[model samples]
Target: MDWAEVGTLVALLAAGALLSGFLAGLLGIGGGAVTVPVLFQVLTTLDVAAETRMQIAIGTSLALIIPTSIRSLRAHLAKGAVDTVLLRQWIVTVPLGAMLGGAVANLLPSDVLEAIFAAIALVLGLRMLIGKLPFLLGRDLPGRVGRTVAGLVIGGLSAIMGIGGGVLNNTFMTLYGRTMHQAVATSAGVGVLIAVPGVVPFVVGGWGRPDLPPFSLGNVSLAALAILIPLSMPTVKLGATLAHRLTRRQLEIGFGLFLLTVSVRFIASAL
Candidate 1:
């Protein structure tokens, strides 16, 4: 690519990163939802092969999530909104699940992965949109065994979908009666758990592949990470601050709308 073209791409990515960072803090999502799609488009522009493009995007997103989640978690921690007990319960199991997910993602087709992301997002979006009547499993969170299983599922799916586990974790927490603020805060911690271990399998899976783009480490693109990380970090605090300011119902509506939009976009891409 020419210098002008590269500059344009960087500009586009920078914009996405800023938004992703804000969403990370605001929603505790670690910004993978935005990062993955933006990276996929960038890869497409670089003429990356369709088969590997999604994996690269997902891998890069996970890598970016590590720092983004940390920043977001720290911001939420200051507010005393995080649910430490729940985070502790899932720390071990979630990482294991993320590793398993990364391995599974390597075997799956890109379209299939997109479909999974879309389907889950659609369901969660619809659930959140039905604001007045939440679909609850019980008045309290599940017991240890149940929480472990939930953690596993959250980790695995988030890994595959290139998310920070916030979407799934938030849903899980809220279904059991936790407040939206608490769910968002705790999900930031979950993102840290999922992303730290999730990135390894992707690195191993895509290592030295012929189809990869330049400056790649397995399925991750160093260029994209370099551009995204710095731009995304500062905005996380801004988003976290906004998250605290918003009302619970407002937060739920916003989250629902964002998920639904993402779902539609991915579904179309998959098709």
Candidate 2:
């Protein structure tokens, strides 16, 4: 990349990292919804092939989310919000699902991935906009079989969408009568599981692809991961602080709007 282009990419990545970090703290999301779209645009500017750009974006987003999710997880853990029992139950299945999801994503067309992301984002957006689900599944979380099934679904979808499992996991938990705080905290753990194992398949899948940018491994862009990880680290703490201060209702509305915006952007890109 030219010096000017490098400078521009760094600036954009910094901005994206900052925003994503804050969101990660505030909402317990891995912030991939925001980062993926921006990275896709940036990668396009670098003339990355259409076939690989979306995969790179998703991989890089998941990679960057590792540190962000860990930080958020720690923050919530301190506050006694995370659900250890639930996390234990999901540990095995979630990673398996994530790996499978990444493998699946490697085979799919970029347009299809974009459409899937858009649809998932729309669901999350509407949930946020409404502030609460209109219905409840039950008063308590499901049993082993149910959780395993949920874990697979969450892990798979999270890998495909390049998200930490926060958004969906939180929604699921809340629907089962868990508080938002607990759901968000636990979702941070979910993000770790998704991002960690999820990175491998993508890297393997994209290995030796001619269209990838420099310092890339498979579909994961090392340059973007480098830029996003450190920059996002501190901001996650700031976001978590802010999260603790906000009313649940306020957080819901903000997250909902954010999802709507990102989903619409992805949909537009696909068209």
TM-score, every prediction: 0.93, 0.95
| TM-score of structure candidate 1 | 0.93
Worst 10 residues of 2 by lDDT: 242-251
Which tens-of-lDDT digit does each residue in 115-206 have in candidate 1?
Answer: 88788878878876886443788899999999999999999999998899887888788889888899999999999999999999889999
Q: Candidate 2, clashing residue pairs? A: 206-218, 207-218
The regions of model 1 sitting more than 4 angstroms off are 2-4, 132-135, 248-255
* Model 1 worst lDDT window (10 residues): 127-136
Q: Give RMSD to native, each candidate.
A: 1.9, 1.5
What is the per-residue lDDT of model 2 for residues 110-227, given as tens digits with 9 covering 90 to 100? 8898888889989988978887777899999998888999999999999999999788898899999998878888888899989999988899999988888899988999888888
Give me the overall lDDT of model 2.
0.89
Residue pairs clashing, model 1: none
